[model samples]
Target: MAGFFKRIRAGLNTTIGFYLLVVVLFWLKTYLTYRTDFTLGVSGGMQQFLLLVNPIPSALLLFGIALYFRGKLAYWLMLIIDFLQSTWIFANILYYREFSDFLSLGIIKGTGNVQNNLGKSFLEILRPGDFIVYLDIVILILLLLFKVIKIDKRPFKFRYAFSITILSFLLMFAEYSAANANRSGLLTRTFDNNYIVKYLGLNEYAAFNVYQTQKESSTRSKAKAADLKSVQSFIKKNQVSPNVSYFGKEKGKNVFIIHLESFQQFLIDYKVDGKEVTPNINKFYHNQHTIAFDNFYHQVAQGKTSDAEMMLENSLYGLPQGSAMVSYGSSNTFQAAPSLLHQAGGYTSAAFHGDVPTFWNRNNTYKSWGYDYFFSDSYYKNKPNYNVGYGMKDKIFFDQTIPYLQQLPQPFYAKMITLTNHYPYELDKANTDFPATQTGDSTVDPYVQTAHYLDQAFGEFQQYLEKSGLAKNSVVVLYGDHYGISNNHRPAIAKLLGKKSVNKYDLAQFQKVPFMINGSNLDGHIDHIYGGEIDVLPTLLHLLGIKNDNTIQFGHDLLSSENRQIVPFRNGDFVSSQFVKSGNTIYDSSTGKELDLDNRQKKLLDEQQRFVNDSLSNSDKVVYGDLLRFHKLKGYQNVNKKDYDYTKKHALKQLQQSDRKHQTSLVDQNGGKSTVPDFKTNAPELK
Candidate 1:
């Protein structure tokens, strides 16, 4: 053992061995950071294997460059490489903590804005253990000081260095080919960044992000106004008229949109151990004052919840690649719900989310969308006990926002986003009264409990609204933003669902999310009309007695008898009442059997596919070209970017000032007090 140790030390002291050592150390640190810090979707053994092998080529390519030089110059170059690489990993760690997203070159361009927005709170993003990433440099410096590693006496050889560099590149190409074989077009196609990082590595994703950003930028520059004509024409031709019975039911009523994170339709009446998972929502769905859609699907793409938000607000499809909020938000021209309602119906608009203003760039995007105020994380008590994975726990979020909601002017459009039932679903154990599932997967057990907790919170909030008299004149809207459990967890979820087998079609069906609207004037019925997030804007606009004609909305009123039932997903897949098309496979919606489409069916599918393409392309052009600036809609007023200030302090102050000036706010009418005490909840966190 002593002899082996001596030989190892002797080799490590040599120049070549030092280079290998530094490269290995760097890869090890990055791998550890990936496994520990970021949720890069390492769910199974295959993903873990990929994560292990992914860092090899990048580490070699980076550290190998230092090998071409000898002595102090090479040593310094290796150190610089180490510093830069570590810095990249550290930045990603901080970014993932806040956004649950990977960094992109386009987003990083706003570094100054991000830093300025975060202020001192940015320091909170750093964990104490993050300092461990620098320990390798400390060890190396100590070794050099102790004369354990000395500069090599040999002169540099370019031929040897060049061959090693070539060998590294060849190995990378071979590995990439193997990965693509496992998942076809793995390298070429743009996918969710999680898949990229899971299959490749962070370093590879950075390089790929740069390539994608440049490609997209080039496409944007080449986009022409002529691109707008086709999209506008298609929207105009396909637009549906509003149903007379539902056209103006909720006109002049306050709008309260509740965005439920990760709450799926499957949980509507689902039970485990004889206890309902979402009892409150189930009751609300069947209420006489509520209208609910059973087959409603969230049409979010890579942006997930943010994409759903964009689609709901703008009646436009989210970008196929990345989040429109993070990618095109600052630059895009939106004809959104807030702006449209304000201009057309004399409504005031505000949004409440218990998260940092910049999570999805809502701080900036809301301004462009013409929201009058935004209440973000600063307005909430986001302590660890009150806050969970994404943001504030549901009970606290709802309980605290009553004051702010009361201060909004009459006929206000307000949105409140809840966050307890987010992905990797976990809740404080004391908070849940529900029993666990018999399924062996521990990961699936907590989902029901958390969802139940969210339901209870909602019930409490609903009672408060009714008691406070706000429910009399408010249209309360509820919807799930996107899927909670990913396909990777489908097997376990299937077992819990009592399915013999679950396939992609089953998964797609499981993508159904709850969509409901409750109001005193609404004649509650189970509307079988199929719709997605994009259809929400026009549907709600029609309810407010605002016509969507002459507007650039791509969706139709769901209440319309002529509402289009075809729903196109972002990935070129689509679902209709009769068929579910995924990639090249077509399935009968009733039987779930694969179908060989006849000529007529084929033509219809092809046309639907083309419409999907044209719609997406046109939406992208509207965003990229800022075409809304070119055409003025009949009643729409151009959103003065200065109409809103997004700071929580400023927003609250504005609400206070409005309350004083008008003295007509609900809180002022109730003698200048908060109604939070009216809310009741069984949330264990509050205990």
Candidate 2:
């Protein structure tokens, strides 16, 4: 035993031995972090083993770079590289804690994605054990300086270094092959970070992200005008004709888009103990002034809220991988609603959210969309009591927006992003007294409380609009961004839905979210329209009497005679008026039973599937190929992102300067006086 220990100690004193030591430590540290810090959804013995071993290839490939150096410099180089890796890991740890997901390459290069509230959020996420990520580095540095682990003053042979590099390549190939065998086409299939990190380590994820970024960049770089013709042809072929009954009904009306975060359509009139959960939203949803879609769904992928926003504003699908807003919003050209409405009609576009401007890269994304003003958390009277887990409390957010909302010009397009009902559904007791569900689910129980609070806030907002007279001239649209309850809490969801079990059909139904358009002049109808978020832009354009001729949009207006209403989920799963396709099986939409495939039924299903597939593929092409950059709308200029700024000083100054002569704002129209005093709310947070 003593002889073996002595031999190991002697080997450790060599430069090659030091590199091996560093690699081992790096691999171990990464594995430990993966188990402790991240929720990669490792399952089965195979997945567990894969997760355990994924770090080695990256560690070997990276640490082996120091092998080329001679003497003590090699040891120092390894340690320095170790320090950088540690820093990167620690940064991800902080980010992952808050977002429950890994950071993307775009975030580092974002205008505010990395910098916005980074200090406060990062410090809050930092735990005592987080220091351990770098503790090994500190120890290794000290050991090297103190000469406890001596570095051999020998030069590495060229063959030895080359062998190490080649070995890393071999290991990487094996890991990738294993992952592919486990999940076919693991690299190209999905963009969900958990799947990526579960199969491959963080280093490989970063490499993949860089590759995706470069691929997108190169595709855009090599894009030609001819590349867009096919995309345009596809869009034109699928073009939906506007319905004569509802076309241009809400013309010249102020458009208010209220984003109900984490809300599902089942909650529309859902009751607990004979009491409505979202009383206010339920009221607006069913009222005679609203055009409600009972079958509307949100089509979001890994991008979530940002994806919803992209589909709503630009009528384009988000990238199958990472957020298009984060990846392409800064540089990609867009014919978004904000810019389109502004240029087509004399309307100002604004987005009001209580969160930081950088959360979904909305700071830059909004600029690209040509929003004239962005009323973020900074624009609100932010108090300690007013804040919630995600951002400002819903009631306070609505209450604070009175002044900003009043200042916006008439016929303006404003999107209000509510945040109180966000994930982890933690709401302070003071915010609402709504009873928690009896599901005993940590996630599902408290969801009602936050959702109820959002409802109350929405009610107050509607009342205020009526009192302030904004309701008379404005058309308000409400939508749920994405699914609040994920598939992980199946037991709780089944209990909540009063089902014995939650199957794929039930999960498909869970994707439904509320979509309503309320306006005083419009006839109310609860239309059973099977449309998704992608259709929002075209619908709104038609409502506003704006013609969308010679433009490329993947979605059709819901109130259109020609709309076939085939809503495709991000995962290629689709729900139509007739059938719901989940994985390999198809279910009847009306019966929720698996289709007994007759020859005719099979043929019809196959045709619909092809249409859904083609629509998604063409939309993706528009984004990846930057086809919009080549396809220009007649007399409409693409948005200049630099012209818009989200800062408080700049937004206010521009609003005042530009609207000085026009006197077009609601406040200007309300006798050149503030109408905020008329708005009333009983929010406890305000008190």
Candidate 3:
């Protein structure tokens, strides 16, 4: 026993013990600083201290055991374990949804300070004060004490090395199992069974079990096909095609649609530095027949960027529940805005983005959307690489589009998606044309500078339009795709603002992005209609003097007096809407609200539900390839007068036959049973 004690003591005096002590102390210091952000009362303090200290004891026990048995091999093994654990933890935290939200701390209530401080580069913010210097020193001292005083005399051992290798393998296996368990649960909840199995790699046995359960549940509660058919019939009967005046008449007009990357409304506010940050956009807003939707909101689902694009162009609702862009990309049949316009008005359309077309499977989606051509980073020539984080410079993007515009036929629709304002706002020095100012952090300054530069680029584009004589005959629309939130200077931002709020939603202004429309031929007056990205296509169609069947649109035109209000829906529920008529009653999905069904309210609700069902069903079909193949559906030619008479009769006969067969099939399927539940009697009033 005495000799054993002597051996343990000797091991503690080795370099292995020294490094383990250093790491533990460092972790402890970091945890302490983390806890200081919140003031813990006595009991809370004790709990926190214990929580933080428990890891130390556990680590020490493992380290001590390894050191006593393994010697030199144990030390190297411990280092490897520490590295793996730290890397995993950091990756987990970084990728977690909540991490990007730290940018909201700097936003003032009234000022539109939408500039994200989160997107700055690592080196730009790397400085002496960037780390907790005092805590670091304390950790160093603890490490030195363990190394020099306690663990300097230990010798190497083969047995200890073997023990560490086995332990490390076990530890890694355990960690991986825990991570996989959580991921599996998350995937099952979010995605369909087939999707989970194919894209998420769920084992066949587990996936089959989930599939069987879902299938049984669906069978028991599924709406009858007959009832769905009746609902569709009702919608078709009540559906009125909008006789929009501005749609097809404005021929030979160039249409420019700029989808700004993360340009939120909060960023539109003039800063205190006497410089107008978004001057170009503000100027365009004032000079055009603009409608600034103060209550505009985005319904960002899984594919935040692509969702915005789909909603804006196609007037489609947000992505279906549990749709990850990666998985959804594999499916090729999603209907969208450009295709509809192409079919209706013979408008030549092209889509451009400054990133790789394949980034979000946009190349496929765009091709499916009837875009005559798609331009991306590869499309541009002699372009300066702007390390603006995401892609080519917005300035160069606009410049490249100019030649294309001049060469294209009249009355073309060009969609330009900018990238200079993407996250990690710090523009690579190679990308920026402006001189960087000292803003304590090099990255933050570049972001602000990039915004200024983007504003300039927009102005130049506008000038180009005017110079080319297309300004007077062009319709221009601009909006942000999503908000940026990826910077490391969040702590500093919180300190600068004297508040500690995190996440963009916590800040009301982060959701607001500028949506504006300008056209010289149109009236120069502002419309205060509430709208969102979903309304953009309908509104644009209205402005272009092009009227479609309108039965397909879930969104209303801003210019239409019949439905002037916009109702924003997000996450399987309505967020806000002027069109939703309520009688001193609030309808919330989370907190049940008893929907008081007054006559008007009932009518509106019924209409909305019908619209929702049709849209959802059709959109689902479109996305899943049950509808026409997106790529093949293009190149539709309109019949001339001589052929129109014959074609019209044939079309009418086919439509009638199709409708009759569809109804008969529904009747056979459901025995003519109504699936519409009696809302007044069956469902409880949502409070």
Candidate 1 versus the native: TM-score?
Answer: 0.77
Ranking by lDDT: 2, 1, 3
Clashes counted in candidate 1 amount to 0
User: What local lDDT does model 1 show for residue 80?
Assistant: 87
What digit string (tens of lDDT, one per residue) describes model 3 on residues 504-528? 2223234556787777666555555
Clashing pairs in 2: none
Candidate numbers, best TM-score first, in rank order: 2, 1, 3
RMSD of each: 6.0, 4.6, 16.5
lDDT of each: 0.79, 0.83, 0.50
Off by over 4 Å in 1: 1-67, 70-206, 215-227, 381-384, 646-653, 656-664, 667-678, 682-687
Give the winner by TM-score: 2
Tens digits of per-residue lDDT for model 1 on 1-687? Answer: 999999988888777788889989998998898787776545556667778888888888888898888888887788889988888888877767545567677556644443323433346446788888888988987888887888775755888778878878887787677667666776554345766777778888889878876777676667666767777898888889999898888898889899888888889888887888888899999999999998899888657777899989998787655677777777767788888888877678888888778877788888889999888888876667887766788888887788788887777899988888875566776786788776676556677888888888899999998888889988999999987665555567688779977876887788889899998989998988878888889989888788888888887788888875888787657888767886556888778888889998889888876776666767776766667776678867778777788776787788888767767667765787767677887766676
The estimated TM-scores of all candidates read 0.77, 0.82, 0.57
Better of 1 and 3 by lDDT: 1
Q: What is the lDDT of candidate 2?
A: 0.83
Alpha carbon lDDT of residue 104, candidate 2?
Answer: 67
